[model samples]
Target chain A: MIPAEGFFWSWILPALIFGVSLWATVALYRRFSR
Target chain B: MIRFGSIDIFWTSLFLLLMVGGAFWFYRLARRSESDFFLAGRGLPWWLPASSVFSTHTATDTPMWITGVIYKDGLRGLWYTFFSAWTAIGAFVAARIFRRSLAYTQAEWQSLRFSGLGAELLRGWMAGWQVFMNMFILGWVGIAMGKVGELVFGWPVWVGLIVPSLITAIYTLAAGYWGVVMGDFLQGIVAVFAILLVSLVGVVAAGGPGEITGKLVELGQEWRLDPFAFTGVSDGDFPMLWWLTMLVIAVVGGFGMGTSIDWYVEAQRIQSAKTVRDATYGLWAGGAITLIRNAFWAVSILAFFVMLPDIKDTAVSELGWFRLGFELLPMGLIGVFFGAILAIHLSTISSHLNLGALYFTRDLYQRYLNPEASEQKLVVVGRWTTAVLLIGSFFYGMMMEEITQWLIFALWLMSAGIWLPNILQVVWWRFNAWGYLAAWMANLGVSWLVVWILPGFNLLPELPDHIQFWLLMALGACFFLPATFLTKPEPMDRLVQYYVMTRPLGWWGPVHREAVRRGLIEETKKESGPVTRSMGIRRSWTPEAAQEWTREDWIAILLSPLVYTGLLFGLVQVLLMQMEGFALLGAAVIGTLIIYWVIDPKLKAVSEEFEAGQARFLDEVEARSRWEEA
Candidate 1:
């Protein structure tokens, strides 16, 4: 029964973590391999 | 029991086909070699191993356990699982250390880290214990799967345990670690989406957040929305002191000592990474995924609370998650959900089978029974062992019908008993073979005395959970210290070799000096500080020899996981719609950016080194292939 604000932000935190870590790892992999 | 519709059956069958097809894709990559079967030829990229590690830990029981926690303690109940952040930090630091040791299994580490009869005995004992442990875990997961099957398909519980387990065993036995990892990757994706689907359905079913909140308030359970408040007993009381005691013990034991990964299967997955960089990043990725999984489950379970507030504690504990999925997910999605549950059970069992086989084949068969065994023979043996383990776990699961009862016993007894020894084996320098033997013996003996013998004889009152935990850890220390002192220390040569290779940060002063004297490592100083690299040393001294943490090592290896752990908790809070948790979310984003910035250079360097190594390996394989053709 969380508010709409809760729904919006809940999605944001996990997305932020997932996007950032994935980007970091892929960037490192590409840089090193090249 | 919920009856399966045709749409459910079709979706479940399709999902199962995808898993099997993915397993076959990896099967072709596997060769008839021990390393190929057991460690993916020790050349996995970060994502494969990381995804596998995350997937393997997400057993069928995971959501059930999380639901039980939320049912009993509300949002604050995450502390129980959050403690693993410490282990993740420890893993980040230890990933390179374990990888550098160049041992195939942790059991084989006995020979790499120590020497003589004591080392041999410890190696054998560890092999046996790990085999037994994996089977126990396999059986535990099987029991959970059986329960899920009984609830979902209206089938006998044993039917549930045997069928999916048999399928998992076939792929694992055929392709070893390769199949296990690939299967895990696919299953991990499906399971995540399934959990998300359930959460989405629940949210809509509850008439959105406003209505859900209204329902919660009407039920007089508004406090459940508070992430910081420790509402005790789920019925709503303050458990002030008890909560504090648990926090202290968990931080000290789980964070301070235990490896971030499962000491067996997950450790094996990390070790199989192509480079130390991959190993560390893989764990970080896995940790992030695990957090996301938790958030999804938490969201769904909270919605369940809103929809079914009047349900009793016993009923919720036994079948809360099952009922929620059955009630909410549509016909086709129910099949998907069922497939996802099977996937969860499959991932756990496959890793156990694969890892158990590795321990037996590498640590026992090669080390003792058949030193001359060929790679192909070892691979065959590993496959056979996987089959045996799967069958054994199936029978054990059938016998242990009551999942809830066994789950409690496992948490309070086996987990507590092993916690101390498990940690000491990784971090403490003085914890030798005898000490390990003594700690486990004392833990089991004392656990038996406190839980069974003393209570049975009425010699003393049954100690409370916290008191018993302390007693077991204390008894472990008491026996371990005495045994270590009384027995001879490990040989100096083995200790020095281990210190040089692993470069573990700890009290290894004597061994370090010996290694230096033997010209194993040279002391050199850069402007930054004294840096110890495992290369030929030059006779130069700029400052006193002292171990200092590199920026990358400190931030990426030690602190990133801690930061990520907070990020995960924050995500859970956000999902619960607590706006105050936005600050924590901000901190997580900032922290992740900082760590990524600091660690990128180190990861780059390590990745390049791994690339060169892999190139050389590929060249050799090509040469060998050509020679065989000639």
Candidate 2:
């Protein structure tokens, strides 16, 4: 018996990771430029 | 005096039975021979090594420590540690770059690069240094884990460290790499599941993340990013200067250490790869896994902060937090969570033992004494060394003495002054025989002198030890590089052919064709043998391999990390929360099954590519060595 409402939309939780991912992706892309 | 009732007894019993039994089962699968004992025949797929590396390192103490740091600092601290995962990936680069070099150990690579007694002496000294260093690290690791055991089982210091270390040592000695890997793999699953399960229970026990975040958020804005942000402490924690110095030393000195040199976890994967590529990918996969796995610990710490804000004596202390978690978790999952924690503890201890033993056998005894020892003898020696190191670690844990009050300083000295100089030579071509050997002797001399003398000085402002170490290394490098060049130029023929055969990415000469025409081999290969180019002296290799973003592999590499992050996120977010109770359980099962199904095939293909690349790299190395002789 627990709440399962908004684990999907936990913006704060994902924010840090998402930012790092975006940065890593962009940097890698800019460098690789195939 | 403290006493535990039947319930407490049951918890310890359950943990011991699961991990020790699992370890025994893994040991049963061990094959005879050096490769089997050390590398598991390099046949395990990506998921296993990926999981094991993180799991083995994330021991009983690690979760509690994260919780303690986060409870004190919040999310930023947790996220900061995840960056080490990035450092670990550098090893993946190392594995891909140097994994399949025909040399058996990182030291062996040095030997191949050097000539005559200069090589042999350098090899022995490096081996000795590693053995000396592991003695400290292994003991510290043991003590850290033992502190957790004390909290869990109400065991005393003697029992806590000795018992666990003994069990890990005995099991590892019997099992070898195959046993360690299987144990670690099983341990990883249990550890993550346990942490996740306890975290859920902790969240339920302490409201939820929303409520928890509200408390943490209210702690002033500065607290969010850096714990020391609002402390008004101008110096910061160790100050900006110190932090920058440590970071530079870490990144720069790390280049010299080479793959399978420092981190035991990296070494395990490096040994087990079917080829260099497999090792590289496996390690990168390890990085990915570490990044994802840290989330569980972070979330759990968040839960702890919410549930027990003022974790005074009992909560913040290593054993104290687990006791708090035990109280929070509901009964059935408690057994499972304990199993996970135990898995984490045992796997970490075993990995440490294996690594410590590795330094003792490969670096010290074998390098110095038994160069012609059979594979079987080495394996036996590895096992015995593991046992001896375990005993030493247990005692060291017991008598964990005070180090030079500035731990960061000593660590820097070890890394920069000692390890960095050696690592630097591999990249810097001017790092010739005399210079390379001098780096070691110089570091030893300067460090020993500084420890005994400089600390007592009156005007000695608080300077970082690592920076000093870095300075010492730089000085050593410059001193050795020039002196050697003036003294002797590495017998021209050996140097030229050595350079030509390796096809390394960097070198000092564009004169190879002209030298070839004129029979000037020295000019053909101005600087000889294997070395790194980026951080070392300037040089470029023939047929320069464009390692990063090979157009064909880029898609797979880029897609892999994304897919992995996505899949993990989806499972944790979507399905785990799609429903509750049995539905949540079903979702985890289904998600794991699906993710594994997709990832296993992809990992296989990546491993095959890496293995092929590594084999070729090895062939090139051997050819280069022979060509130098020619």
Candidate 3:
């Protein structure tokens, strides 16, 4: 079985990075909406 | 050789069709004008080009190189990848400055930054060099994909190189940057997902993080887990001096354009963004994600090490990550992984194909051959050039083995000598076209002697890479510094105009003072105030107020390196389940948030003001190109 830290690095951290990037994009779109 | 199931073939075929077909959707937009073909009309939302930046950098060979270093040096290998940190400060400094200047490529920026016959010569030389360099990059990357194909499907390397490149070329030829950027967005998503999935699976297959660590300890290889386990200050294979050199290069290189090789690629994305704020955030976020991806790969490579601790040959061991996935992934998922590999390959190929074409079309043909070329004619030329680059890459890919020696020399050729001059051109107002040109010429001869020729003759010992970089920089300065002082400065009017438009950072005092004297700009409070206030941190900015370099910009610049360092080290530690990792990661996040809060408003204001005058600036650039103005 994968340890919690292993799962976090392999899974959760990547997901969080992607999530934050997506959120930033949405925020940019909203702020600079044409 | 690994056997592929029916499900694997199905997934791979579907992904190929989807990416290629999706690119065609932009065919009409790409054909509308020269700008559309090369720069997507410079109206892209930040995210679109941000995805392109991330996707383009994550080429087919990226995983191989990362795995090779991690397997050999343990966690300290992560520092090798940290060179991407240049973008952290570059997003705030060079990206903003270049966006405001409105140059199509770094080659074109040459003419804007310098003047007279020297500027034109530099522009032509730079344009030609970029075209050749891009082809070289395409060849190297293509050959890497060819190797992967050989490994997985038992296909000939030539067949592997040509097929995918041909497929990517179809869309690149049809829709230009429009297709490349749009396709890259989709590819980036798929590539990231595959990377995460494959890395996680590798960890699970290796008996998890805890087991991997325990095994390393049992084998007396626990030092591999320590990121700071350097051999010595200057003695061992992985020395502190080399790390220090990397830190300086990565962080300080940001203040200038073209400091890192990746800057040329990122320049296109910076200009393509809809606004300056978008450009800044896009670059920062893309680079941040890339470093994060490296952290994941670093950890997974460790897992590979624990499983197979005795592999010696770099050629076989470099394939460690791939071995883990292909050997361990289930049938249907293997196909999905292969599809992602195609995504990785195609994104990089398409980007370089389009980029090389831009240099040829904009800088070489239009500037020299036909100043009166129409938009339709220029786009036609762009298509033909894309085809040529694609054909050239095939020949280059096939002959890569014979040229590998020269390729290493070529890599050093660009970085070591020209690095400081690259920074000087941006920050120092007095650095003219002659000095810049002389630097390139001097570097060519000096680097050949320092890196190879002298060593071959036994006149000089073979030096470490970092020592060579410093040696090249010092020797190069001897020639270019004299060339700058001996030659006349760029015309005062030209310097004033450039200063007004770009508001560049660093020692531009004379230009700034002249602009104020001419009533071209307001006399700002002393420039030193902002530099001083950078330490305190803080601003709301009016469009006029934002034009001046201020504390907010300084604060962002100061914090950017910290954030990048924190993210790189923090992610690695967290992967190892260390407590300090959590703290470092938190600090990085907080730093990022503060930068956004401090700088975003000013950037928006700067973009708004700059766009209003961009049309006038474009006309001036056109007139200058035609020699209609002196």
Best by lDDT: 3
Q: Could you give candidate 1's per-residue lDDT for residues B1-630 as a string of tens digits?
A: 675778677767767877766674566556558888988877888898878878998998888888888766667666666644543564555566666555777777666666667777877987887887778788888877887777666779888778888888778978788888878877877777677777767667777666666777888877776656754543234454445555555344433223323645656876788887788778767867777677666666777777666557654563666666676655666777787787777888899999988889888888878776787898889988998988888767776656546555645665676677766666667778878777767876788888778989999787766667767778778888899889877778767757765666656778877887898766534355444432332222222232223545555555565576577777766765667568887787888786766665555564454455555534433332223211
Q: Which candidate is the best by TM-score?
A: 3
Q: How much DockQ does model 2 earn?
A: 0.02
Ten contiguous residues with the weakest lDDT in model 1 chain B: B538-547
Compose the digit string of candidate 3's lDDT tens values, residues B509-538.
999999999999887564333321344544
Tens-place lDDT digits, model 2, residues B1-630? 233445444654655654555555445445366556666666665565666677666766666666566556654454334334333334433454345344545565566666667776776665565655566666666666666666666667677667766776666888787667766765665565555655666655556655555656675432542322433323544344544454454333324444223443465566576654456556656665665565555555555555445557635443434654566554444444555566677887787677666666766666566656677798889888877777777666666656524443446555556555555444444456676666667766776555546656743444445355555666666656666666654445544444443322224243244346656333323545664443332233322222222322333333433343343333333312323324443454454454344333433444454454555555555343333332
**Which portions of model 3 miss their true places by more than 4 Å?**
A1-34, B526-538
User: Candidate 1, which segments miss by more than 4 Å at Cα?
Assistant: A1-34, B231-261, B313-318, B402-414, B457-459, B526-548, B556-558, B603-630
Candidate 3, residue B282: Cα displacement in angstroms equals 1.4
Displacement of the residue B182 alpha carbon in candidate 1, Å: 0.2
Error of 1 at B431 (Å): 2.8
Q: Give the C-alpha miss distance for residue B204 in model 3, angstroms.
A: 1.5
Q: Relative to the unseen true structure, what is the C-alpha lDDT of residue B397 in candidate 3, on a scale of 0 to 100?
A: 82
Error of 3 at B210 (Å): 1.3
How large a fraction of the reference contact set does each model reproduce? 0.00, 0.00, 0.00
B100 in model 2: Cα distance from truth in Å? Answer: 1.8
Candidate 2, lDDT over the whole model: 0.53
lDDT per model vs. reference: 0.68, 0.53, 0.86
What does candidate 3 score on TM? 0.93
